[model samples]
Target: MLTLRMFIQKSDVISFKNMEDLYSRLNISKNLKDEFKSLISELNDYLDRYSPLTINSHEMRFEKLSTSEPNPDQLTNRELMDIYLYGDYAHLDSSKRVRFERIAQNNLFAPMGNHVFVTIVNKLVEIIDRAVEMNKQAIEQLKDQI
Candidate 1:
């Protein structure tokens, strides 16, 4: 039996695009698909709420703001999610860690804080677990028929 821990330990950084590829390869069910979409939408909403000033500004202001470069370490929630999903958290630079800590301290973001990020990751891992379980069941059934 595949436990969540085992599954996560075996996983690599799966980009958003790559997740779609995995879904195709696994032939994931509609329920799982909808759940994945909902999780993604929630992540998007969080990102929109906490989006950096540059990306959140008005179009007219963009031209002027465009001249000034945004801090590469000033990541959106989505970017942070990507990092958590695929990147080595332990290896993250001090700057990125500080930036993430700042976001965790934000009044608006504090309510959900790190929990939301963890929840999304856990949900994705659950999907993978379910897929593996389903595959095992199918294999066993096939064996029974033979």
Candidate 2:
């Protein structure tokens, strides 16, 4: 008997696009065509990367803002000028947004301070959610076959 190990391989990114593409090429089923394509699009969007800003509350007048741990760093003058930083940077002005986008694309700034670390954490969460969704959809499809 083939072991479960035989069914799965390492290095699988487990995106909807990969799954749909693989099954469609094999001509899995007519009923699954539309649903599979839609799932692939959703999965692709979830996996797509978006740089976001992270914020930690320092000492605040409000009790809600109080935190025992403080963020490690803040942006430097040079970093603030970069465009990529705007991906996560929140500003009312479009000009500032453009500047940050330039900074990020240039890779001119390093992730500094508590806010940057928070942004990293947030991105990690998004990654996990996408992975989970992809795996779940794949598993459900497998179950239908069995």
Model 1: what TM-score?
0.38
Clash totals for all candidate models: 1, 15
For model 1, the stretches where C-alpha displacement exceeds 4 angstroms are: 1-78, 83-88, 93-95, 141-146
By how many angstroms RMSD does model 1 differ from the true structure? Answer: 9.2
> Candidate 2 vs. truth: CA RMSD?
13.7
The global Cα lDDT (0 to 1) of model 2 is: 0.40
Alpha-carbon runs more than 4 Å astray in model 2? 1-111
Per residue, candidate 2 scores C-alpha lDDT tens digits across 1-146 of: 01211112123444334555575764344555665566545434432322233222332111222234323323322233222333354323476565444334443233333344345435434544554564566667677788
lDDT for each residue of candidate 1 in 11-123, tens digit (9 for 90 to 100): 53444344544544554466555655554455346543322421222111112223355544344445655444333354555655655555455666544445656755665
Q: All candidates' TM-scores?
A: 0.38, 0.28
How far off is residue 90 in model 2, in Å? 31
Clashes of 2: 15
